[model samples]
Target: MKKIETFCPVRDILSQFGDKWSVLVLILLEDRQVLRFSELAKAIPDVSQKMLTVTLRSLESYHLVARKVYPEVPPRVEYSLTELGQSLLRPMHSLIDWALDHKDECLK
Candidate 1:
């Protein structure tokens, strides 16, 4: 395949998890360890159900989130970060720290 045919890793990764909702979802999971769909929805009150679903699907597709389903009368589903996802938290924290430190300057 030509070089152009190869996907840009940086762009692809950002496209997958660049949005506010995606970052919020990942951060929530990082803090909570495990949460049900409803719990996640409740925690992020501004996020619509559809947006949450989409974000969760994207994270799961990236292997950053794991979904577990329990076969029960009503069924139970939970989400948590994988090892790879946990590893990403370190860099995310660094980015967050940078943003905080530059917030005033960037806003001006």
Candidate 2:
């Protein structure tokens, strides 16, 4: 097997996934398979429409989320995790589990 480079810039990777909304969006979409923009907005109750748009665009740019457009009278769009994004499920779940396990102590 070929060695993958570990030298890719950490700052860039951090910037991509480090944001609160980005992680939340990724987590919400992980098990759902796909979601429309309005569904995402409802799922993440505190997120503003603008923030949702920005986060989705950023994820799309990173090739982490696939945005599909359906040709219809009103036009429909759906977001789903790409293969790369799905790979994040294990680590994201670990983080969520850790947070839940420590929430009371950590927040105190």
Candidate 3:
């Protein structure tokens, strides 16, 4: 297959997942498959409610995450990865592995 050249820099891609909260949300959803807003907040206590809301919205806008709202008495919302989002796990995990492997060098 031929590779298409583009003017876009890798930083554009990195900017999306490079944020502190986005990757954490992604990894959490990846492990749990799906989670409610409360569950995510509980799992990541350091993330403010506003930040989590913003992160989920951004991820949803990018088509990397799906949000489902259920009609109930108080209402319910859940978050999960889309097919496109699932594709990201491989590279994300690879980066995690690389960081773990190079932790000593990186810390120096």
Q: lDDT for each of the candidates? A: 0.92, 0.90, 0.91
Please give the RMSD of candidate 1 to the true structure.
Answer: 3.1
Residue 58 error, candidate 1, Å: 0.2
Residue 91 error, candidate 1, Å:
0.4
Model 1: per-residue Cα lDDT over 6-100, one tens digit each: 66887789899888898888899999999999999999999999999999999999999999999997999999999988988899889889999
Candidate 3 lDDT tens digits, 46-66: 999999999999899889999
- Clashing residue pairs, candidate 3? none
By descending TM-score, how would the candidates be arranged? 1, 3, 2
What residue runs in model 2 are displaced by over 4 Å at the alpha carbon? 1-8
Range of the 10 consecutive residues with the lowest summed lDDT in candidate 1 = 1-10
Candidate 3 vs. true structure, TM-score: 0.88
Candidate 3 Cα deviation (angstroms), residue 82: 0.3
Top model number, lDDT: 1
Model 3: residues >4 Å from true position, as ranges? 1-9
Total backbone clashes of model 2?
0
